[model samples]
Structure formats: C-alpha cells, structure tokens
Target: MDHDHVRDVDPAVADALEGELERQRSTLQMIASENHVSRAVVDAQGSVLTNKYAEGYPGSRYYGGCEYADEVEQLAIDRAAELFGAEHVNVQPHSGTQANQAVYFAMLEPGDRILSLDLTHGGHLSHGHPANFVGQLYEVEQYEVDAETGYIDYDGLEEQAAEFDPDIVVSGYSAYPRDIDWERIQDVADDVDALHLADIAHITGLVAAGVHSSPVGIADFVTGSTHKTIRAGRGGIVMCDEEYADDVDAAVFPGGQGGPLMHNVAGKAVGFEEALQPEFEEYAEQTVANAKALGETLADEGFSLVSGGTDNHLVLVDLRESHPDTSGGDAEVALEEAGIVLNGNTVPGETRSAFDPSGIRAGTPALTTRGFDEDDCRKVGELIARVIDAPDDEAVKAEVREEVEALCAANPLYEDD
Candidate 1:
C-alpha cells in the first residue's frame, strides 16, 4: 500500500492516493454497485501488463510482443465462462455500459426500437436513457414495476412489447431489490420476435454464485460489471451463446474500443480464480443475508422499503413516508457525515428530482467483505435510522461517527498494509 514510487514521481498524486485509501478504511461503503477487491487482484491490476497493447482476441492481436497479454486475456475469458456457465464470454469492454454497447452494436442498427425498464423503477442509462447515446440513436420505450407490489409488472411488460414491437427487449436492473424472472422476460421477447438483453450489472456475483437466477442461457445477450458483488477489478463482461461469439468479439473490439486494457484483464483473471473457491460462495450468501437483516432493521425503525424487504444484497429505502420533511439527498449528506457511505436513489413513483431523489439504496457486499454479519448490519441500520431521525443534530452525528469508528476497528480492512 506504500506508494513510494508514486511519491518519488509526484508527491501530490501520492498524497491523494493515500487519502483515498484512508477514506475507504475509515468509512462504511454501502453503495450497492461497489465492493472491495482483494490485494492480489489489486496487484494484478497494477502489474506490468499495463504496458502491453493487445488489440484483437487472444492469438489474433493487432500488436506485437503480446504473448503474456494473450495468456492473461485468455485466462480471464476462460474463468468468466466457467463462473457464469456462459457459452461465450468477452472480457474486453472497459465497463458495464460498454458491455451493453457491444450487445447493441452486434445485434441492432441505429433507429432500432428498444424496450426496457424505466430508470426511476431501477433501470440503467445504457438501457436507453435520454441523455445517453443509445437514447439518441435508438427509439426507446420503458416499462415499470408494479405500483402496489414493488416488482416488475410482467403482464404489463408483455402487453407493452406486443404494442411497441421493439427490436430488442432489455431486462435486469440497478436499484430494485427483488430477484428477477428472467425466463418470463425472455418469453415476452420471444413472442415479439425481439432479442433479449439482460444487464446483470448489479447482481453479477449473486447470479454467478447461484444465489440468484441467471440469464446467460435464457437471454440472447447478458452483460455485467466485473467489480460490484463479484469483487473483481473495474471492467465489464459480455456473455452469449457461441452462435453470436464472433459478432460480440468484433463489436467489443473495433466497434467500441481499440486495444484492450490488459492490466484489467489480468485483474479479472485473478479475481475470477479467487471466486471459484468455496469461501467466495460463503461470502456471497452472507452478503444477501446481511442485506435482509439491514432491511428488516430499517423497516422496524419505520423506514419504508421499496419492496417491503430485499432478496439480494441491497435495500431501497423510500424516505417519503418515514421522514416527510427530509429528502433522500438530505439523508445522504447527513449519513455521510456520520461515516456511513451509500447513495440517494430514485423510487418507483418518484415525486422529487433524480439528483435529489426520495429514496436511499444501501447494500452489504462491501460490509460483508469486511466480515460483517447480520448483527453488525442491524446495528448499522439502527445507526442510519438515528441519523435520518435527527439529520441536523451535531450531537447525534458525532455519536454515530464514534460508533462507526469502533466498527471499523473491530473489522479492520487492509490491516497488513
């Protein structure tokens, strides 16, 4: 963890790196889409592989001196295939958004119609949000979760697909807490003769560990982030049946990106190898259990959860009913002051702006990574409730900050460093 080399070159950048390391060690990271990667993975990501420029897949690279780069990239692709049981896996895209872009580039042309879940109801920007390039390039329509149950309205989605006759139907989500019915969505797409793209960016680890349903075989295309619950380094993956392998590989390379980030591919290979071990399964299970405990505790404290509770590693808390005067943005700032870090998210029927939404989404992947259990998460939940109840009270914030410090001490992160 010592950045002596960086310090020798640039003291300011070294100081900033050290500051961020300290910040993560001190604060609780509850952001659902994040996790702490292992030191091995970090080392691999920061390896000499960063100097290589392997442009094409495995053996057919556009650059020379790519022998080690080919080995690392092949290991990543093979490990990912084994982890997800995917017929084909492309580990080149820089991020989850690019993974989705690869699918679109392989399958659809500009102006093709897309059907996806609404963002406020737990969808992502790459699924055709107005601000993204996909939205401008394609004709997009969105579906929503049921108003009463806080789950996907499958019947409604089918009806919409029939009406819109879209070229591609996108499934999966970002903030929604419940498990998805991938088969049902796939069937709807089948009926419309549309391609199914399931973006499992948030729950890739859960799906890989068999805790949640997978879309690798059911959907025509499956995309995910390598980091999140998977605890890999920062990157993206695309999976599909072998029939679409060439199209996907081509799209990910020359279509969207030039040379691959070989350092990240090495990180992915190391992380995937780690995940193949038995303990990673235990970690994945504990992560979901901790989320359930957190949601139950929050509900007991009168916070309204989006789906009443969670089945995965995240809980979406709708703050409108519990604290009528407080906005999610307000709660976010207050909780961060108390050393708990998570994001303000939008709810199903959002009345507020997306920037300062009405809900907060908390997850247990990072907490569980730090060896937190159900009891610890419940205590964290209680701490969150206290801060939301008295967001402006300096006394309450100081008390909560002290407790957070104690928790961090008990569950030390990067202790060797």
Candidate 2:
C-alpha cells in the first residue's frame, strides 16, 4: 500500500511509516512474542473501522452506527471460539495483559493471593512483577523453573501453592522453550481450590493449529495476544466456559478497557479466517521444526540451550556457560548489527539484571512466515554462533550482514510492495 493520502497530509509521519515498513521487510524478527501478520490483516487494521467507538460486545454496543462493528466483532469471536474450542470468547481486550486483568477483575478481590512464575524464570511482567499494578494491588508469590533442568518445577510449585494457598495460579510464559503441561498446573490449582489462568500469549497460534497442547478446556481461564503466534492483529482475547461468559465480558469492557479497537477486531476476523486455512497448520508445524533445527545447530556449535532444546517455535540460550565474557545484551547488540533481530532475555538462576541478562531468546515464527525452512534456520544459527563467538569482530559482522541480505532476498517478505 502506497498510503498516498498519508503522504499528502503529513510528510514526516509518512516517511516514518515507510521506514518502519522497510525495516520489517529487511530484518529478521526473532522475538518469540512477535510475528508477521498477513497483508490482509494489516489492511483490515488500517481500515475505517477505527473511527467507530464500539464500547461493548457485539449486538449490544454503547454507541450508535455499530452494525458493521457488530458484524466484525462477532466474526472474530466466532472464529476464535471455533479455533480454540472455547465455550465463550471475548475479543475486546486491548492486549494480553488486559485479558489477564479481566480475569483478575472478574474473579479476584483486592489483596487476594497470586502464585505465578518468576519473571527471570520466563514469566511475563503482568504476572505479578513489582513494576506492574497487579503486584501492588495483590499479594504475589513466585515459583521458579528447575535451574538444573530449565523446566518448570511442578513439584515445587505445588508445594508452594499448598503453603501459600493462593487465590489463583498463573501459568504460561514469555521465554520458555518447553511445552507446558496444562493439566499438571490445573491439577495443582484444583488441589489448592484455586483458579488457573493460563496465558498462552506466546503460543496462541500453535495451540489453535494443534502444534502445541491447548489450555482451553483444561484451564479455568485462557488468555492470549492476537498478534503473536496467532497472526490475528494486535489485541487480546479471553476464553472460558459458558458460566464465566458474562463476567468475562463485563470485566473486559467497562471494568478494564473502554471502547474496543474495532479496526483491530476487523483485523482479527480477517486473520482468524486465514488461520483456519489448511496451510496455517503447516506453517505452525514448520515453525516448531525450524526452531528445533536452529537449536540443534546452536547446540552442535557448543552453545548451551535452556531445556537442552525446544518443543515450540522458540529456544532460550543461556550465554553464561557458553560465552562467559558476553552478556545477553552484548550478544543482542552484536547480532542486531549483523542483521539478526531478537531479544536479550533472563534465564533461570540469572546472575545479571533483567535489562542486561545472560540469555538470548530466538524464535522461528517470522522466519517461517517468510518461507524459511529448517535448513535456512540452521544456517541462521551458524551465523548467530559466529557473531556471539566474536561480537567485536567487524569483518565477521560485515560478512554475516551480507549473508543476511542474501537470505532476506531469497525469502522475500512484502515482495509485491
């Protein structure tokens, strides 16, 4: 899309928009929580629906002229319900964090206890980090991953739950590489007579496409970001049984967010339609396969991987053992300079601070979207090893950057534009 109207109205904003588009076209987005949505999704998000102020659910809006808005929101909800086998789905959450907030607002009282995974152990900030509102408003306790195994310590979590008697148990993660056992976590919550909120923000698409186990029926509440693995634009969704439908809807609307982002809801409808296609399953499967290949390549090069590998679209590499001199931030900067874009992440038993942690998390969702296969990801892994092995070497960075350009060309993104 040329966005000629935008250029005519505002030159500076137009240039920035064009620059952002070019950046996406050229860079490899390896952030586990990020993905490349289809062109249709982008168009839908940029549509006229943004002008509407649909402050409530479909067929019942707080504003007028919502017929089209109702249509779009209903379609999004229907598609998501089908995709997840959820008894009820709320597509109005502004983000995954808001989705979590909806659950909290619906069920928990002020100062209620929350048991969640630690941020440094692959948990999200919304899951009771001190910097967030939930931490201040609620009593929070955190569990850790098994430092030696790089997996969730289920036994430890259960013990903690027993001791703490939390009001709710939060599962799912941001940087975790292993597949989550929803049933295990649910059992713990059950034993404690607590609720379970599984935030599958990072694996929404994998769950929908059956590439990973779903937490829909297993957990009491499930939440996710529509833009991440789901490729359904930038928003949040909540799923639960019919009994919690009204409560979830109320919590998401007047309780947490005001007017829904109707344009993004349109984008969700379009993207969810695309996800239902047979090819999406293949894309989801290939994403996991590519991650495995990338992790295997890095492991072969003597890089230490959390959990020793991945069963999903991402892998977390602990740099402390493999590259003691380099921090995750250092490797991340050097890698970005060499044209590979991912994040510096915290690992279990982290020694450094979160801002400059000791781990790097890489995912294959965007690469696979660009038509990259396992072989291509292996090559990418080799480049990563080289750059991290000698982050200060200009010659190596230049060489790798050239290769990155070639790879981008071969697996072209937005080529028509």
Candidate 3:
C-alpha cells in the first residue's frame, strides 16, 4: 500500500494518478457494479505478460513460447472453476456481454425462442433488447416485474415461459435491487426444456465471497464481469456444468470472439485467487451493509428507493417521486459537479431514455473498498440529498463539495490497499 516502495510508475503520471486517487478519496463511488482492485491484482494486471499475443487456448496456442502464459492463464481458468464450483469456466471472454454471447451462440439457433427479463424492468442489453441482434436474430420474449412491488413475479415469468416455450431463459438484471430465485428459474426451464443462464455480473463477487447466494449450483449457465463485484480488470467469465463444457468453450473461441486477452486473463486469475481469501468475504459483507445504510439514509431523507430498498450493492432511487424537478440525468450531472460519481439509470417503469433516465443508480461496493462504513454511507446519503434537492443551487453544490472533500480527506483512497 506504500507508494515509497513502488517503482514502476512514472513520477509525473503517478502524480496525475494521485489526483484521481484524491478524487476517489474525496468523493463516494456508488456505481453498483464497480469495486477497487487489490494491489496484488493491479500488479498482476501490469505484469510482463502484456507483451505476449498468445492466441488460442493454453496447450493449443497458435504462437510458440506461450508456455508460461499458458500456466498463468490456466491458473485463472482452473481457480475460477474451483471458486464458483463450476464444472467448466471460460475466462477468455472480453466482458460479461461477450460471455453472454458465447452462451447464446452455443445453444440457441437463429430464430430460436429466448425468454429474458425486459430491459426497462431489469435486464442487460445483451439479454435480447430489440436493438440487439439477439432480438433480431432470435425470437425474444420478455417478462416484467410486478407493477406494484417492483419484484419479478415468478408466476408471471413461468406463464411467459409456458407461452413462449423458448429454447433459452435469461434470468438477471443490471438495475434490479434484490436477489433472484435461480431455483425457480431452473424449475421453469425444466418445464419449458430451456437452457437457464443467470448473469450474476453485479453480484458475482458477493456470491464468490459467500455474502450472497449464487446461481452456480442451480443454473445451467453463469456469466459475469470480473471487474464489477469481483474487483479485477475489465473482462468477463462464463461457467457451466460439465454437460455444456465443450459447447461453451467452442462457442467462446470460434463462436463469439477471436483472440483472448492473455494479460487480462492473468489478471482474472489473480482476482479469482483474491476472492478465495478470507478478508474478501468481510469486504463483501461490509459492501452490503454500507449499501443498506445508504438506502436507509436516502429513504429517511425523503427519497423513494425502488423495490422499497436494496438487498444488494445497488439502489434505484426514483427521484421523480420526491424531487420531481431533477431527472436522473440532472442528478447525475449535479452530483458529478459536487465531486460524487454515479450513473443515471432507468427504473422498472422508466419513461425516460438511458441518456436521461428517471432514476439514479447508486451503490456502496466501490466506496466500501475505500474503507467507508455505515456512518460514511449516511453522510454520503446527506450529500446526495443536498445535490438532488437543489440541482441548480451553486451554493448547495459548493457546500456538498466541501463536505465530500472532508469525507475524502478522512478516507484517503488507495492509502490502505
């Protein structure tokens, strides 16, 4: 964690980088699927392995002299498999979307019926949004959450599955704030003879740390981002039972993507090992606790949290209900001006576009990594409240900025590692 011992980075770049660190320390990071990687993981990502362009799988590389890279890559693949109890893992996909694509290519034929969570409700773009090829190439059916509770009604999902009788069922979300019923999806899959894919991209790290229930043992397919909750670099991973091992591998290699990111693969390996550590579990637990605290504080401040509150890292704060003047886009800019970082997102029934969503999607995983606790979360909620309640008031924004600076001065990002 000490900068004095670190030698690889340039002094000027390091100074510039330190400013970003100061920004992180000063502001709160609430992006649901973001986290700070450990020093070890960062080192692994920056290792000499980046020099190689080793294409193809370990023992079967197109280029020679990939023996060592092969070992590092295999370490990631095998360890990831162990960590998630996955019979097979392809740690090669460029991201969670790419990982999802692999599965779709492997299983569903063009025009095959595929059921997924409706995007506006709680789904990723890769989950067959009409604009995406999945919808154009495949017959896609969407299921929505309950109109009242903002939770997915298992009955409604089943009814859709029965009606569609699709070839694959996607169960996951990007903005959703509760745990999913993987077993129930599996049951529905059985009823429809569909392949069930659970994209736990947001909760993958929590699941790995045992702080959250995982879809590994229950679902036929699992896809995730190594960066999000796992806190590695930008990349994706796919895992499945032995039954789909060969198909998944072939789909990822020849089906979805071309060359593998060997350096990032090495990085994923490091992160997977880090997740196996004991303290990582503690970090995940605190991440959720901080999220709950932030959610409670926000609610207490008169904001309406979608699903009433969060059971995970992120919360969908429907600002329309409280601060009708501020759209998600307005709040996003307002908060950014006050030194806070978060994304504007669509709510369950969001009428706004993604560029100007109706809700602000906030979470605590990244802030908790900076050693923030519940008290910090509450103060962050207050800071966010000020910005949302008075988006145009420069004085309020300045005051919130000062409070954020004080909070950052206390935490001091990347100082503890």
Give candidate 2 misplaced runs (Cα > 4 Å).
none
Q: Candidate 1: deviation at residue 229, Å?
A: 0.3
Backbone clash total for model 3 is 2
Q: Residues 1-417, candidate 2: write the lDDT tens digits.
A: 586899999999999999988777787889888898988999999999989998887878888999999999999999999999999999988899999999999999999999999999999999999999889889999999999999998999999999999999999999999999999999999999999999999999999999999999999999999988889899999999999989998998899989998899999999999999999999999999999999999999999999999999999999998899999999999999999999999999999999999999999999999999999999999999999999999999999999998899999887788
TM-score of 1: 0.99
Backbone clash count, each prediction separately = 0, 0, 2
Give lDDT tens digits, candidate 3, residues 57-131. Answer: 889988999999899989998888878888888899999999999999998889898899988787989999988
The true-versus-predicted C-alpha distance at residue 165 of model 3, in Å, is 1.4
Query: Pairs clashing in candidate 2?
Result: none
Worst ten-residue run, lDDT, model 2? 20-29
* Model 1 lDDT tens row, 196-251: 99999999999889899899889999999999999889999999999999999999
Residue 109, model 2: Cα distance from true site in angstroms: 0.6
Off by over 4 Å in 3: 1-22
